[model samples]
Target: MSFAPEELLACALARLIVARPTAHVAVGAASPVPAAACWLAVKRGAPIRLSLLHKRSGNPFTEGSRELFDLTGQGRVDLFFLGGGQIDGQANLNLIGTGEWPGREVRFPGSFGSAFMYMMAGRTILFREEHSPRVLVERVAHVSAPGVSEPGVFRRGHAQALVTGKCVFAFDPARGRFILESVHPGETVESVRAATGFGFDVAAGVGETPAPTEGELALLRGPVRDEMLETYPEFCGRVFGRRAAA
Candidate 1:
């Protein structure tokens, strides 16, 4: 079965979820892909708890961010998703945007708990839909959160992988670099290499990211669309069609 690019990416990320031994996942409001992956994991009988900041029902938080922070800091949450306006080979993220500090020429939304969450969360996955050199840079102008902190910094964890539109990169904290894991369909290693601004190690047997299985696609196209409709109606309408009004 065929899936849209976003759906394919979501499925890829869902696979990533399975690759890691996670118990709880907390998805940000703007992260439709990660949210879908969390729901998909549940549908596949993974016995995982999900906390969606915007879900209409089954939202664990009674209030706001305090509980989320508390859970993460305590290491109760196993995984979380983070995005950046810019990410580099070292995994430094610049939610602050490019250009000089104090003020930038193009400023993204200021870092919202990213620095703390990236460290506190047991595993953080950097997810960026755009994978071009413009966003994937050789260096972030300002490091809101360095992927690998200096010794003695109280960081519980850091980024595991970067899932992009083109490929997946596994980060190595020891080596302080990223390793090319898998290239998505229709994208070649050379293409990914050309598009990425930062240098990375490529696995000798780097392979194509597996497509979403028929079962996974069916779930996404059917009940998963309905489940997300409460908090993500527009996304469901665009990606899965609610009531055939597309």
Candidate 2:
């Protein structure tokens, strides 16, 4: 039984969430993988939380997951999962526009509260559903959220791990830069690099990201699914839609 790319990516992300002891919250859109990871972490007894916004009200997640919004403001959120159209070596993300000529390329789904969350969330885990040079670029046309910036600036919180289809990366806190942390099984650093335009530091010995255990899958399918269905309709739609697609 083989899984599709998005499923594989989601399962890998679930494993990464399990690996981190400090992670208490998993923040991402209603995407399947991120949602699955967050749900799995919760069932694994990691005090997981979700995010949701009202479709008609436009209120900031008034009902779906209050735990996450409260945690962010109180400085309790530790880990968040995100994806973007473009990311830089510094781990900065850009989901704002296509960047053809500032406002020309393509308008994107607004930066889905990334700027607000990134400003306070202590750590983040970034993932890309697809692995391609265009998706993993050297620079971003716009700065949707600053991953790493100078001291005393707006963004100081860190983007801890980036889980891509090809590999995983960890950020160096001192310089606020990214270092290759792990490559998924059957992937190579050279191949991963071919997708990127700029250079990033690779750790001495990059290992393969571990596969998800049965426990992880169970957790994702059980409590997380039930909770979302009970609480968040839009999120449930997005997650179930993507999972069905996969």
Candidate 3:
């Protein structure tokens, strides 16, 4: 059965989420895809907890980010999703836009608690639908969150993988570089390399990303859609042909 690209990406992310021991997963703002993936995993009986920070209503945290931060600080959050205006080979994230310190040229949304979460969370999964040389830079102009801290620095975790529109890259924190895991359908290694600015190692015998199973598609279009309708109505409508109530 044919599926939307968002559905494919969501299935891929759900696979990643369930691959490891994820007790509590926290998703931040402007992350409909990751949120959908979390719900998909839960619907599949992955036994994962979700803390969606951008939910419009019925939000888990009454005190907002303060409570979320407290959970993360206590290592209760096993996974989190992050993206940036720029992501480099070293996994440094730059939410502060291009140009000098504080991004005087093109200002992105100010980094609020990202550095803290990046350091405190058990692990992170980076997602960016737009995969291009500009978005994946050789070096970020400013470091909003360093992927790997210095020796002895108190860091709970690092990035696990980066999921882009073109491919999936598994981060190797010890080497401070990404390793090509799999390319999305219709994307080739050469094509991904051409679009990427930073250098990365390619996994041996890397293959195309597996298509979503029929069961996975059913869950995404059904239970997952139901769960996300309120929080991401536009996404649900576009990807699952469902709309939220007025």
Candidate 4:
């Protein structure tokens, strides 16, 4: 059966979530892809506690991100999703914009709690669909969040993986670099290299990313889509052909 790119990405992310011992997953307000992946993992019986910050109803927090921050500080949030206007090989995020302090050239959404969440969360999965030299850079103009801390610093966790449109990269906190794990269909190592600005190591015998299984496709098209309809109606309609009621 055919599946949209979003569904494929969600399935990939679900696999990553279930691959590890994830007890709780938190998705940010602008992250529809991670939210869908969290729901898919639950539907697949991963026993993961999902916290959708943008849920229209039954939101877990009462006073916005304050409670979320509190939980993250207490190490209750196991996995979180983060993205930036620019990400470097070291996984440092640049949400401050491009050029100059405070990004006088190209302004992006200011970083609110990314540094805290990145340091305190058990692990982070960086997701950015647009994979280009502009988005993936050699170095971020500003460090909104440092992917790896120096010795003697207290860091709860680091980025586990970065999912892009072209491939999946496994991050190595020890070396502070990315390793190409798999290339998506229709992409090759050369293509990914051409698109990326930073250098990375390639996994030996790198292979294609596995397509969504039949079971995964069923859940995404059915229950997963249902759960996302309210929070991500436009995404559901565009990718799953299900529209929310007016």
Candidate 5:
């Protein structure tokens, strides 16, 4: 059977998570769609250091979100994944306003602690489900979080690997440039170009991203899915309604 977009995205994210080196913890925000899906990599038996941020002390969780920030501050987190409303060739992301600003053409959800996480994390993984000229642009409207303000420092700390509907890319360390590393199944260089708004470097003889393995599917259908249902029962209830119980 063919995999749906969500399943394709889930598998791709799972693969990316598996590729990351181990760390003490992995912190994802309230919107855990990507995080939950990617957790399958760990489920599939890929080694990873991960834990969910349920809530704060005295509020209701085993550990607080502060741990994530503190760990990153000390350079403990090895990898993280983030979605963006807009991205550039430099991998500088924008999750804030879209148009002229304040009361302009379009407005978007403000940056959700992206500034701190992007600045302090050891490595960042960026993915965009919708790949189109408007979503991937030459430059962002504003720097929601500074990627490389004065060059050397921020640039070195910020190593971004971007995955989109059509292709996968990693920023070149030398110039902090985004270079196409691989194309997804059935995707071509031309298709990637047509989807993106800016120019990006493509590696010579780039290959297709490997498909997800059986192990990954089991992980998604097992512990990971159950945990999400239990941990976010209210959210799940909203999606599936009261019928979720049956």
Candidate 6:
């Protein structure tokens, strides 16, 4: 089955989540893709708990992000999703803005609890749809959240992988560099390297990302897609399709 990029990516991310099962997974704002992936894992029968901070309904937290912070701080959440306006080779995230701080060229929704979550969560997956050199930079103009905290800085964990439109990168915190995991279909390692601003190591046997299977597509379009509509009606309509005649 020919799957859309979003569906393929959802399957890819779901596989990642399934490989390393986590008890509790937290989905943050502007992360419909990751949220869909988490739900897909569950629908596929991978036992894991999903917390959707962006969802209007089905979100258990009545006090908003405060509870999310509490869970991360307490190490109750095993996985969390993070995104950035810019991400560097070292995995540092810049959600604040571009140029100098406080007075920048572009302003994003300034870093709220990202710094805390990035440091607190056992595993954080960075997802971004755009993979151009502009978005993947050699170094961010501003550091909203440092990827690898300084020694004795009290960081519990760091990024595991970065999923983008073109490829998937596994971050090696010890090496402080990203390793090209796999390139999506219709994209080459050379193209991904050319598009990225920073340097990274390509695995010896790098391969194309596996396409979404017919079964996976069925699940994604059915239950997985339905669950997303409650939290992301626009996204569901835009990527999957509009609900059945209301």
Write model 2 residue lDDT over 1-246, tens digit each, in one string. 333454456667766676766535645563556766666656667655444432234433544665466667677777676778787777778878775645477876768878777777777788776778777777878888887767677653677777777888877767767788777778888887887665789999887776655565445445666655644566555654456455
Clashes of each: 0, 1, 0, 0, 0, 0
Measured against the true structure, the TM-scores of the candidates, in listed sequence, are 0.95, 0.77, 0.95, 0.96, 0.81, 0.96
Off by over 4 Å in 2: 21-23, 49-71, 100-102, 154-156, 221-246
- Cα lDDT tens digits, model 1, 1-246, are 667888888888888888889889989744698888888888888889888877767778986768899889899988989999999999998989777884368888888888888999998888999999999999998888889988888888889899999999999998989999999999999999999999999988899999998899888877788788889877888888833564
* Residues 1-246 of candidate 3: C-alpha lDDT, one tens digit per residue: 888888888988998999999999999884689988999899989888788887778888988569999989999999998999999999999998888777889999977778999999999999989999999999998999999999888999999999999999999999999999999999999999999999999999899999999998988888898889898877788778832232
Better of 4 and 6 by lDDT: 4
Report each candidate's C-alpha RMSD, comma-separated, in the order given.
1.6, 4.4, 2.2, 2.0, 3.8, 1.7
Report the lDDT tens digits of candidate 5 across residue range 1-246. 344444556676666666656553354653454556546766666666665665332332344557677767788776766667788877777888677764165676777767877777777778786789888888988667654556465422565677777878877645768888888888988899888988888888788877656665556555666656765566445433333344
What is the C-alpha lDDT profile of model 4 across 23-54, one tens digit per residue? Answer: 99989854688888899999988888888888
> Considering only N, C-alpha and C atoms within 3 Å, which residue pairs clash in candidate 1?
none
* CA lDDT scores, all candidates in order: 0.87, 0.67, 0.90, 0.90, 0.67, 0.88
Q: Residue 102 in model 5: shift from native, Å?
A: 3.7
| Model 5 error, position 213 (Å) | 2.4
Give residue 208's error in model 6 in angstroms: 0.3
Report the alpha-carbon TM-score of model 2 versus the true structure: 0.77
For model 4, what is the alpha-carbon lDDT of residue 32?
86
* lDDT of prediction 3: 0.90
